[model samples]
Target: MVECGAKHLIYVSRSAGKSKDDENFLHELQVHGCRTQTFAEDVADSSLIKKVVQNAAKPIAGVIQMSMILKVQGTWNLHNAIPGKDLDFFVLFSSLSGILGQIGQVNYAAANTFLKAFVQYRYSLGLPASVLDISAMADIGYVSNRPSVLAQLRCAGMQMLKEPDVLDALRLAILRSLPTPSAAYETTSTMATGFHSVSNPAHLATAVATDTSILDDEETSGELLAIQIGKQLLTFMLSTESEEELDLGRAPSDMGVDFLVSIEIRNSWRQSFRSEITVLGILNAHSLKDLGKMAAKNLKEKFERRNEAMK
Candidate 1:
């Protein structure tokens, strides 16, 4: 609407429901030479949705709420929206869950994977418009039910930050972006010093306090693991320059053991912009090998029980 010399634009989302704010939003749009159209039908209903899209003015941009798990259903609805030239942009509100699968949300992961692929495909073909996927982080928003493993990782990561000055870390992230594209950036002050050794807290504390050039023989470890991970991530962005294509051949499960805990820093601008860092952490046990074994045993037992029940 901003492109077509529209001084006013009102978007009526059916998902907005019958709230008074929706009507007020329409009214606000009218003040700027725009109108609102609300559909009283389900977003997933293809037949009725097609009719709604057909009635809308030229250059329609529709927002679809889709999860990563429901691949077939989500993609089908998106595919249906592609028939019209008026459909300028299909905005999909997806989740980081698609990129980093949540433990219990396998179906969500599948759906989001499909959406990411679909968006990339559309981009590849140089379609007149674009398919945009907006993904949300797991840490942000109301996260009352976050898993214990995730909480542990966050705690570990935070503890590492305490050694470094917050301002220095922000400066480092900014310095890291000087050779890349970063629009706006923020980093915790606690990200400067690398992790200390695990054995000696006193040695770690002494290292922080005094200007000791030599390594302590007492064996000390700090939260350097998290900082190393962070620096490596920043380095990857600096190396890739954000031109790396999505590895389409890789399956969701084959991604990595630390799939969910990985952070992605993308350069989203046409020019060299600031680094946009998004973190995804998994809340599983400390040892992946042990966890996998336990999970396998549990699954085998369940299968055996089911077989006995069937007989």
Candidate 2:
């Protein structure tokens, strides 16, 4: 933070620095002309936070919250501590596990997810906030120490970001949330990385089959999604043993897709995409093409403020 031109920094934690390394780090910062203070107080305790702010070297200009369980109550306290209007940036360091969910870290994921919702709340109030949903780091963190952990993440197709990559992301987050909100800039942004390891051909190949990010337009995505759904319907109906035999324009009713099959399709869709298409709705679809269009329309209507109706 000091390297990025922050002169005065107040560090609050449950405990203050007690190690020789900690003293040396503080000395290093001081040598670089950075004013710093460390407060040992529970962020959950609102009264203690009051004291920290009351004795501030300067009125708090910004906040960068490095997160976890403390994020839950700590974030709320911080929100209450400093008025949003006064802040230049309120940045949260969250993990990708918050969005994708991790196997053994339910508490951690939930905490990170809370920060995301908190950011949204702040945004609705027209305050500046940004959450960095960082992936597992390859070096300089806990994951780097555990080979088993690293292997698991690799197998799951998660790319481990290096320190430099993380720093770059942090720089952008701070830059993007500065000064004032703009028409083009999302005031409350979620910056994330490691969703894809583009450098690895094997990883790219594994993700490419269902990855829609490669498509720059939603129209193409909708079309592809429709085709994928249609293929699933074909296999469900047992229309033929081959994908080529499935008629795209043939009505579901003509192909003997009864109420039972419609129910199954509806359930399958709900399981996959949280689709709310009713059994009757599926049966009434004029053709396989219409079914896809119906799904597309449903999506647009459900997610968009304004939508085009199917003729």
Candidate 3:
């Protein structure tokens, strides 16, 4: 995209292997007669991030970065550095895991949650920069593969939990407790279709009942609206599949897990922004055991039905 007269860009990633990949990227760009500057740094390392931002060329028109394990505040700090005069836009790559916490990635969920909050904060600040959170498919590459003794232990505990249909009973009870409520109101143009207002449970409960009143008197700019619409579309397109399909057990080096993308907007003035947080991966042997038991029970039921039909 840069080769076609795209003058300014910022690319951020946590992959240690980016240096090697960057060399190839630079070479390709050079072949196209495009001169560009690239910085490779870790988001978790504050010093490195500061250095990278300070080194950016003057008149910076755009900033693009991906926040993985790093906290949302860290990414917001980077965006804050882009001079208002030089910065025309800021794009943030967030993750679905940040929105919907992963089974074993609580730390990741925390970071992402912060990111969502940061995006709203940025809007409240009234900065010229617009934040976009592009929710993309999970990169199977980042999943861990090593199975430790702890994992085995947890799997065992899961077995006990599942004994005598206890697990199924718990699942049914939880499902039964789910509330079915709806309300309607004016929503942010950037908000995706399934994006719920966990912060306002009451409002969400009656969301379907309320009618959205479009405010013609208050019009948002085309650029801002475009950014919001684009992000919403991208998020919907990217998060269409089940999280299980991404196979989080694998690591970043694996072929199946390549890369994922998302966007976030940060407005410090309002303290509302997009934050993605993840929990540390914990493999409980008991949980696994219970899952296994449930699977076995399901299979047994299927077998019994088949036998009854034969009879």
Candidate 4:
């Protein structure tokens, strides 16, 4: 907006203080003779947001809603308060989790997903709105801080965007609203579609399609494969010198596994075992050992049912 020669800036946040980066940016804006004011207000609260927007000396031209909460009511209230008639554009910062499920972030994803739907709703009412479902931003933010989660994203084939690139994408999204919320930023790649092993394509291909009924030693084969998957998850999520040394009995959370890591683990199972496991079921696993057992059991049941149908 500063680059576009916005004369006055109204910055709002739940926090009272601005970050060093924010202060520097505001200082630069002021130097350029662009009047600026910061409001310590919760955008989710309709009354607070309405009052702040109403009191602006300059007519509010644009709004960028970045407030994140786990509840739908917050979004609903904010949506009601936004002066669609007065704004040129409304940009909502959404996450890729809304499009693709994330472990331990059901509420976050659902909230963001609502924003996507809300954008469509606004368009139907002839209002200008866009939802930017951003990919993981590298070197900053929640996803990049945790090395384990970042590695998991890489393994799942999610691309990371630099800070400048993200800003550029956001600017473009504001200028042009796309038909689909997912297309808000053409540059940001969507979440990884399916799992692939760089070292061994054959490993994934055969394991994913293995016939349980044909194998004479089904139990042994399943157990070995389960153990292999457990080791793979532990290797990515932990600082393990040796995969063999890692205990299979340790819970994923205990191994420093997070929401994204858990999602990658489930994705791996989905592609490897070709079994339809519920997201809840995957996230609820107590340990890698337990998850592996579930995978093996599901794989066995799938083929057994197929064999029975053929008979």
> If both were scored by TM-score, which would come out higher, candidate 1 or candidate 2?
2
Which residues of candidate 4, in runs, are more than 4 Å off? 16-21, 144-152, 178-311
- The order by descending TM-score is 2, 4, 3, 1
**What are the lDDT scores of the predictions, listed in order?**
0.37, 0.70, 0.38, 0.63
User: By the TM-score metric, which is better: model 3 or model 4?
Assistant: 4
Please write out the lDDT profile of model 3 over residues 1-311, one tens digit for every residue: 45236654455556432667777877777677666666556665667767767776655665555555565656756765555445544444455556556678788777765665654555445433222223321222222233453355345332111121222222222222212222332213222222322222122113212212111111211112222323332343454644224332232123111123112211210122111211111112122222223222333344445546755
Per-residue lDDT tens digits for candidate 1, residues 134-242, read: 2222343223235664465455442222212332222222222111112333211111122332222232233222212111111111122222223333344454423
Q: Residue by residue across 108-165, what tens digits does model 4's lDDT show?
A: 8888788877877777666777667777867777778899989998887876765754
Maximum-TM-score candidate: 2
Query: Model 1 — which ten-residue stretch has the worst lDDT?
Result: 213-222
Q: After superposition, how far is residue 202 of candidate 2 from its true place, in Å?
A: 20
lDDT of 2: 0.70
Task: Name the lDDT value of residue 301 in candidate 3.
Answer: 44
Best by the lDDT measure: 2
Those runs of model 2 whose alpha carbons end farther than 4 Å from true positions after fitting are 145-148, 178-188, 197-311
Give TM per candidate: 0.39, 0.59, 0.42, 0.53
